[model samples]
Target: MSGTAHKADVRSGGQPGSVAVISSHVARGAVGNRAAVFAIETLGHPVIAVPTVLLPWHPGHGPATRIVHDNRQFAGFMADLAHGPFAGEIDAVLSGYLGDADQAAAIAASVAALRSVRPDLVYACDPVIGDESGLYVSGQVARAIAGTLVPVADLATPNRFELAWLSGRVLEDNEAIIDAARALGPPAVLVTSAFAAQPGMTGNLLVLRETAHLAEHAAFDRAPNGTGDLTAALFLAHLVNGRGHLEALRRATASVHDVLANTRARGADELTLAADAALLSEPVSDIDVRSVGRRSEDITIGG
Candidate 1:
């Protein structure tokens, strides 16, 4: 009764590409599958939606009942997706919050299985392990994701805390963040809640093999839960649709800022994504996405 249920004016029909989203499903908040699925679908990519866990709402909102399926049952379900009738439909995979530690290995296996059919299958792993406060998931789950998912992913989106835990270092500055992201195994890593160059600003840092870009927007206190989820989904969708790395990072960061501003205006605890779904596809860009470090590597992102 409390979650978003409105629709966006999408493309004429579902687009050609299909993405498999594996994450949590909250019946009453815009987090995990709820946020990612909407952003991806609005961008015109049909989604093979899969829920890793069921919950009433985000834990930040308060206590809610959690329902994690049996490992064997969950494994069989993923196996079905990999070899099922529509197995070939998945063009990409976006993985997020894990309910069980074993789910990581299963998801890795499925990603591998899907890749066999489509060699260029784009897999973006959002390591939903922790936040500034600390690890929300068990140590085992965090390790599993760092080992099984991040290593095999084409891209990874991890918050600063999660990256710190994964790298076993204190990422006190942008240089350290970039260094840790390089060692994070994924060729492209998008670190959310990254340290910004300017004061009172938050940034999303995209650390690529040869380059890095940081897109900063005004940071707000008590922002919604789904920003990271939405960022990962949008960034991956743009890349799958053939946009370059910097372009995708800029667009995704700008869109998230747009929605965050709108949500704040409405005084909503959760992101008002339903009311701003169209913004995901055509975001109003007032963001400054700049190349990080070294003037030689700096490229102007002209309008």
Candidate 2:
């Protein structure tokens, strides 16, 4: 941040509007890359997601269309980008779920390249790391994402646990979430699994700039993996379309909730957006933007 100048001003070809996502693509499972692709498509943006890791049950049991590559062979894939027509055809970038540090490095470099051509392009980083219990991603990969990838992103969506880990702060409740998000210095923050424990009251908090708003919703009985991907993509799309933070939160939350409800109704494992395509396109029956009021207490930063 010191001398980087933070300049993003470049133009590119190919539709003039698209989102390049950097994350792993699973061929067999409906997780990781498949979720990202679904969310990006729902937001009406073309996606360019490079495969970062390949597992055994891929190509046969995963999403209908998925990019598969060996984790050790990331360089070959990247080298292909440097010499192909894809070198300069990206409008924005949305990244999530890095399997290894090398993958994170590759993604960071690609993000830099995308910025070179699409300077005003919005970069959204979903720094996928650990959940509430413990770290699921390797420490090296987590460090690279927090240290390199996140700082360069214009918008970031990290869950409660990720926020705590990135900020090195203990966040037991809602207020602490805001404090932690502010510390990260990201302009907008969407804490996906926000839970407020104040007796009988329970809700999630969405913070933008320095303002935090709360919305009460029923938490899904089971943890759905792709909810974050959908939330980030929808939030970014709505924000770019001139929707405010709280409004975006409302839309995203409603959308995810509807997806979960549909999944539960069908007794499926994960929230199947494909089954419920309407939820993706029309997250909410109607978009309602309302004032959730200012924080009763201000977040104090120790300079």
Candidate 3:
């Protein structure tokens, strides 16, 4: 969680805008900041990367040293950025994988400070708490994220398990997910690992007030980690570039699918994001997006 400033590449061209990404940093793996920063930069956006934690690689790969900064120092560091001269250059903030519960408050402070000057600032929170196995972080960290960061998020990217955990309900189907997402407080919610109508297919569900769109693609077994992180970054990038919600969802999903497929084909444990940078800019994978009618009960699985 230490604050180390990495200079943004001038080659990005900054066509859309700059994004401030707060997340974990792995030295070798394409997860957390490693995934988000590269994806955003590859898509032609300047990125200010704030690492919440530093690790040798994703813990799933093996044991690695984890470094978290002092809470007071982390707070000051975030405040510095919030009030810094370049703060106005940022168009959005995307956060993922907090190192500690206190870091959540620091992030919230940064978000608040930025929003004070730029009322329309976009903040995307990806609750990287856990997966189907259960919560990987302590209850305090989970609560901090749910109570602090999520409340201020303009958009939230939570997988099915996370959405269920955050909403405190069982989401056995898309209808349940949609209900929970609508009530999740964010204007838009992107639920990954969402239920799909057809077997062997997985979808990223984008739920808005009046409608829900499911972007489905072939599910890859043993997909690498950081797909959620990558999704949030790409989605935010597209939106900042003026793409609508549906288009952003489709493009993000397609890019993630393409990256995962490439990772699987290469037999790599992590997403080959660096090698496959073109996928982020122009994903070749086809994603089928369909509108689902709002429901009071269970949503129909198929049209």
Candidate 4:
């Protein structure tokens, strides 16, 4: 946004790729783009952010004033970014929390446009549709993401509930989650809040081909809302930096785990991402990451 020129091209690896981030923007909390843009930027990538919706704080806190740009305005904004000067530098795109069905189509078009310029542009879609509380968004918005965004995404990060909703299956077990993820059409699918064999933990399951990598961390009650947004952005940034899937998952999960712990320690309602900024770049790996079998039993331990 300043006079700074773009970093060296993504191919040369002189610097990490610039990312185009599309998500909801919250004025006061770390959710959606607020979480994503911070995480990506902290991971040492330039971010071009576009807000699909605006809110004073996370709606989960209570009732709040919000703004969802109509389809026309949002499309125009996305179009400008697609054709903007920095478009050529966007080697990756991370999208989450759509305002409406049309926003999904608009984001898909922009992703296509960016891919036309850079064929290798990675689009990571975090389908922020619902949670255990039931389908939070309108059915139409969820369907649009499942039909439009998920089809075009190179990678998809959906929590267990969203994956279940998208696949029209009851993913009561990790095997069902794996099957649903593979059938959902994304080359890589990371299911957050996945089933955990241990009663007190939760996992982020990364499914690729027949292999599944489960990154398990202690489950905290009443975790903040933006962990999904943060995880998606951090994982995308690590991949754009050329890290492999497992390493990316490990680091992102570790970072998120630390943040959640730190937030809970301070009795804070929001993620302390700003106060814990350095943790994003150098997160301590204290969680359990390992390969899992069809029944989700551990196969190989991560060293």
Clashing pairs in 1: none
Candidate 4 regions with alpha-carbon error over 4 angstroms: 1-15, 295-303
lDDT, candidate 4, 1-303, per-residue tens: 011211225436566568989999999989999999999999888898989889999989899888999899889989889988878888889999987889998999999999889887888999999999998789999999999999998899999999999999999888899999989998889999998889999999998766788988889999988999999998888887777777788888999999999999999999999999998988876766787756454454453
lDDT of 2 at 233: 74
Candidate 1 lDDT by residue in tens digits, 61-111: 898899998999999999999988777767789999999999998999999
Model 2 TM:
0.79
TM-score of each: 0.93, 0.79, 0.92, 0.93
- Model 3 gets an lDDT of 0.86
lDDT of 2 by residue, 4-27 (tens): 112222345424355666666654
The deviation in Å at residue 134 for candidate 2 is 0.7
> What are the Cα lDDT values of the candidates?
0.87, 0.66, 0.86, 0.87
TM-score, ranked from best to worst: 1, 4, 3, 2
Off by over 4 Å in 3: 1-16, 295-303
Ranked by lDDT, the better of candidates 2 and 3 is: 3
What is the lDDT for 48 in model 4? 89
Per-residue lDDT value at 175 in model 2? 73
Q: Cα lDDT for residue 44, model 1?
A: 77
